[model samples]
Target: MDQLPTVQPHSPIMAVLTEIEYESGMEPSFGSIHDFCLELQELFTSSGWFFYVFSLKGVTKDGITGLYRDGSRWTKSKMPFPDIVYNRIHSRRSESSQIFIDFVEKMNEASIPVFNRRFLNKWEVHQWLNSRKNLQRFLPESCVYSRNSLQRMAASHEVLFLKPVNGSRGRDIMRIQSQDSTCDVSLSSRNGIESLNTCQKEDLPAILKRYLKKQLYLLQQGLPLLKMDNRSVDFRILCNRSSKYDWRVTSTVARLSAQGHFAANLAAGGDTIHPLRVLRHFFGEAQSTSKLDMIRELALEAANCTADSSEELFGELGIDVGVDDNGHPWIIEVNSKPSKNDHIGKSSCRPSAKAILEYAQILLSETNPPEKGGSR
Candidate 1:
């Protein structure tokens, strides 16, 4: 596995690995990504790091073959193997492929850092968190999707959520409410929950089978989430590893569910506001500050637990926590590749971009130190 030593680049390169966009007729596109590459390039220009976009095809090649912006157009060329790989691949299916696995293994053997190497599904994450007792309080009862499991959960909890293991943007999420003799099923679309159907306990399985077919789902105990204006509220806490490789809360915001909706995802037309603002509206100003601190602590704990649960390196994580009527935080979900940067910079360097570059530099130095007169 050893090759002749070659001089490392003076300016470290970071390839933002992304999937290709097929519908981008003439213009080059990466995984529905538009201006991300240009913005990152512009942001890192004044720094010692270099950022370029790499396609999934590059992963199977000999060296890192990537594309970069020349002017207004994109140019394809072979790039110096990245000092660090920041995976931005948006497709869960692509990430699960054998090629992606092999690529990550190769990088690991070479001591090349690839942060957020594998996308973690809901079931896998649940199992990981279940390994630690201290973190169990923040987790809801979750199990792999099955008709019997769904019915069993429904029997115990008055409310349950049937979620696709790999579903995103709140699509195909079903909420079930059990009554005396009828079970109600509510389906969430791209926007939010738009329709509901009620059925008997025996009829519920037939309906779900017709809707879900053979697709996998996870059954979760639902929470009576805090609501404002008849719409539920949840918190998205973005945690990033600092230059020192320590977990820190990058930002936290409260998402208000769309009108007549149950899902609070931004892609589902939900609105985001400062968490402190929402807390103040409920709790006193002084209490709001303390409550925010508590949420941050909980988020940090979840972040650490996630990193410790997996063998893969994680540079950042997006932890979604649902606050019940009692203001208790429960782990709703964790996103490995969270892209919502509501707190992005307007004039200065973008915080998320800066954090990524700083973490990359740390990995490069940690993996292989530089010589006396040069950097690794």
Candidate 2:
């Protein structure tokens, strides 16, 4: 790997980028990203470290077209090679673009440390967890969706969740619940739940064939998740590696799904509640605190497990956990590029953003350590 130019340990630069459209002239902004930058700036002094936001097109052989604040206003300026590049590119199409791909390729070639490096698919994580005997208990029985796999799972589990292998935000997930004589399929959407009722059991294959034809899906046994007011609720724990490079739980919130939906993703019309409040509501005060602790521990374990398998540097993870009716916690999903939907205006989540910056500093030092002749 090529090496990024070494810099003074105390005064390294950090560059953050997301998709930018220069033609629109619209200010590049996202609520959570803005708050994150503000907090990162306040925590890391400008005299010590400089932070800049840029676009995909901004990157070139010379440097990045970075945006920095000049007094009370923002200004675009050419920047030097940063000690690290924090990629926040969100658009799939943008990431697939030749320019964006080249930028990442060059960044890697230059050995500029980038953490939270790439997206991990659902099937990949499930496979990793299943391979570990210690962690298998927390995972739902899952397998790549096939006609045989689907039929076998449907026989054992009354309810099965069919999820797109590479999907996020609870999109393109289907719930196949077997009723007495019919199978009810609920497809999750941004607008609302779309339900399909099949009258005959034999018709399930034909019905599912239509939906499962092109896309790859994972068949997971649905847990009897602990519910609040007839709505399923699960916890989303934000875990990050601190400056010390140890995993820590930063923020956790309980997501309550809409009345009939099984998915509790915030993007799927779910509401967020303080984890404790939701825990206490279901498990009561005595057990609620303990349950929260269990969730945190499992989250840390999941983070470490993934880090162990992946070669890429990861500084943060979003772990979704579901507590069964029996009070056992099940790992639902692990996200590499967790959404910032809940971070907006939530002071509690600021630590996660801070941890990312601190971890970046650690990576910078590891990649380009200062000489002993220089100041410690």
Colliding pairs, model 1: none
Position 3, candidate 1: lDDT: 29
Cα shift from native, residue 282, model 2 (Å): 1.5
Residue-level lDDT for 163 in candidate 2: 92
Clashes of 2: 0
Best by TM-score: 2
lDDT of 2 by residue, 130-155 (tens): 88898899999999998799879988
lDDT (10s digit) by residue, model 1, range 210-247: 67746678899989888988988988888988855478
RMSD of 1: 4.3
TM-scores for every candidate against the unseen true structure: 0.87, 0.89
The Cα local distance difference test for each model comes to: 0.76, 0.77
TM-score of 1: 0.87
Model 1, clash count? 0
